[model samples]
Target: MFQGMPLAGAQAGGGIVSLIVPLVLMVAIFYFLMIRPQNKKQKQRNAMLNQLKKGDKIVTIGGLHGTIAEITDDVVVLRVNDVTKLTFDRNAISSAVSRETAVE
Candidate 1:
């Protein structure tokens, strides 16, 4: 009876360890596959937003396209046409279509 009890306890302990290893592996995979890529994309988006300047043609998240007419710390003015300019939060700009480069 004593030998049987020891064997059962050892088996239970090994079962718990086996379960723990797979659980840990799943968490690691989730972080690498999901969380890490999301964080990298967020950093790239922030860098793009910070580099925004006036005259850069941009597309908004809502699909509106225009040139940046004016910029402030938290606001952007988009010129859709000669008489149509719109104001939006800096974060509303999705991607810069083109950046105006200085002519040498």
Candidate 2:
């Protein structure tokens, strides 16, 4: 008849719910604050790579700047200068430098 049990402490089963609620909130906060933006950025980068074409000036992940001379399935030929053309993997190409940014 509830004579030997204490029902108003950490053993009453309410502590688990309180602990889990904060943990779930922290996870949601982390996903929104950190994971979401990174995923969006990656999607934008992938879209840029898929839309690449010849004469588009770009900079590689390794800091090499050039114009796209040719694009194959997995390779990109960059016209670094008049006489220098370098071959690199498609994934190595980083963000595309806007045409306006290169003119100034």
lDDT of 2 by residue, 1-104 (tens): 98887777756588888899999999999999999999999999999999999999999999999999999889999999999999999999988999889953
lDDT of 1 by residue, 1-104 (tens): 56545566658978999999999999999999999999999999999999998888888999998888999999999999899999999999888775454221
Q: Give the runs in model 1 whose Cα sits over 4 Å from its true position.
A: 1-10, 99-104
lDDT of 2 at 22: 100
Give the CA lDDT, 0 to 100, for residue 83 in model 1: 100
Measured by TM-score, how close is model 2 to the native structure? 0.85
TM of each candidate vs. truth: 0.82, 0.85
Error of 2 at 27 (Å): 0.5
**CA displacement after TM-score superposition, residue 69 of candidate 1 (Å):** 0.9
Query: What's the true lDDT of residue 41 in model 2?
Result: 95
Give Cα distance to truth, residue 89, candidate 1, Å: 1.1
- What RMSD, rounded to one decimal, does every model reach? 4.4, 3.6
Clashing pairs in 2: none
